[model samples]
Target: MTTEIHVTTLGHWSNSSAGPTTSFHLAADDAEVMLDVGVDPVGRLQAAGLSPTDVTHVYVSHLHSDHVGGFANFVFTRSLLNRAGDVPLLKLTIVGHPSVLAGLKELLRVQYPEREFDLAWVECGEEPVALGGQLTMRLVPTDHPVPCYGVVVETGRARIGFTADTGPVPSHQHDFAGCDVLIGEAFGLRGDVGESIHRRGHMTAEDLGELVAATRPKFVVPFHFGQEYADADKRAELLSACGAAEVTTVDPVDAKPVIIGG
Candidate 1:
């Protein structure tokens, strides 16, 4: 049961990067799961040859425009496609804290004045979410200004852990241990004010290096790059710092989409 995890970069790091976002597509043979739908995620899905209708579950990291920018679009697409009877309105499960969900509702009212949903919100205080088959998500708190949660997502044989936005490594680093792949946030490069000046909403490249040092995942995918450094150098620096993990940076648009158990 070797599970496969596919990652697609819906959001990449560029000088004029409109949305500081990334979309992950993790699937197992037949089941499909989308993680962190943000900043034109629906458009990114389309660009990756997928539809919002294909997404079964969406696991959010934290409540930031970059992370959740595509929520309204995803919801709007789903609502437009599923007309209360179109294919039974695919069960879209959003995993996050209760307050985070609340904040989203407030955001929706402002973002999409004519938006509604026939979905379920899983406020993962402690209980994990079973995404129908071959997939489950367990949440762990991360170091962010607001209440944020990282995810330990397991689908068949592949386990992908994500640290959305963290100041540095999570204190509970052991929680996401033994994952096949880990996608950590590297907002800014080392020696840059990305560490010293940011309001703790994002992290610096050095901070992600700490994540690699603390958690030894097989592959470390560095994402959420700030407009300060080239992703290539940032990845190299992070990998060199880890010394044990294979680090890869995902280009939100060009990176391959992960298809599990295929």
Candidate 2:
């Protein structure tokens, strides 16, 4: 059996006409994982030719609305589908920091008090968590105003890293080192927005470039910017910053899967 991992960015912008927010769908062998349940995730998944029921795991980086606002909607949609006999209820495992999980649980309870879900919770810890088959994930703490975590997913044949929502955290270089693909946040251009970007706990293109330089990932996918950066010239500028670090930048706006292995 050949091992292949496909990473697709369902939503890439922080805020703008191009947003549902920051979300990604990763499929490998026996696992289908969602990096974040950004707003309108169900619609985004469907737009990407996928369904919420197909997801086996969801990893929440933080409790921010942009990252977790659609979580209840996803769960509710799945439950409704199962109730309507459109699909069978599958146990969905949610991986996140304890606080994040708690917040999600409360959100679900408040949003759907009349329903029950086949859900499992896993708290992010220092140890890597296996996601069945040959896939395993390690959640590393990231620098953010609120509790947030970056994730590294390893298949037998490939390793993918996600920086989540963060500022320039030097320690993350060691955690994301040797990744085949690194999906990083490029919220803006360095100095273009001054210290506001860092103050918000988000990285600029230059910050992401520094990370790419340190990690040396084979491919760096930049996302989580506004619509302004979606323009061809601005996009190129963003790519130039990261690419100058000697790493290839895969534009997440293309909505194409970045395939690894096989």
Candidate 3:
């Protein structure tokens, strides 16, 4: 069973990248899933040679606009883009925390009073939910300003962890222990900016580096970078702090899929 992970969008909210906001697409033998749906998620999927129906499940970390702004568009396309007859649209399941689930429904209800899609919402707790026979995922609370979670996805062959918009939390290392790939967020460098400037919201590059070093994932792909850590030199410095590990830096605009196992 092979696994393909694509970084659809590679920037934070304030980034000027050509593509949409930060999102990830995970394609495995068991299930096709999306990590987040940022702005222009449909466009991002098109760029990745996929359609709206290709994504069966979406795991939303939080209710930030940069992360879930494209959710309405995604549901609308999947609901209406199908055959205009008796054929039903594809079933799209959205998984998130209890708080996120409530906000999500209200967010969509405001735009779409008459819900036409066969959408399902699942609330994730401490227990892991089996999306497929070989795919299982669990959400762990992270240190963010709002209620946010860092997702851990485990496949038959590899385990992938995504630290979505989190501050320095030592427990995350244990949460995502022994992952094959860790997709972390580095908004900026820690020492570069004043320590007080980055507190409780996003992780700095240095902070992520230390976290990665503790977990020691096989590959570290950092995203959600800010202007301070956007340069190649700055990114390299961040990767260097992770000790000796394979680092694949995703481009801010367009990037090819990074296959973890085959």
Assess each prediction's global lDDT (C-alpha) against the native. 0.67, 0.86, 0.74
User: How do the candidates rank by lDDT, highest first?
Assistant: 2, 3, 1
Candidate 3 lDDT tens digits, 1-262: 3445443442344343523577888777746788878877788788778777667789999998888888888888776667664655557888989999898888888988877557788888767888767878899788888899889888777788898988788788799789877888876566765455457577776777788778888777677765555566765775565334555544443366667654
Model 2 alpha-carbon miss at residue 87, Å: 6.5
Rank order (by TM-score, best first): 2, 3, 1
Q: Give per-candidate clash totals.
A: 8, 0, 0
Model 3 clashes, total count: 0
Q: For model 1, what is the C-alpha lDDT against the true structure?
A: 0.67
- RMSD of model 3 against the true structure: 2.7
Q: Can you write out model 2's per-residue Cα lDDT over 85-142, one digit (the tens) per residue?
A: 6556678999987888999999999999988888999877757888678878888888
* TM-score per candidate, chains pooled: 0.82, 0.94, 0.88
Model 2, poorest ten-residue lDDT window? Answer: 80-89
Clashing pairs in 2: none
For model 1 the TM-score comes to 0.82
True-structure Cα RMSD, model 1: 3.4
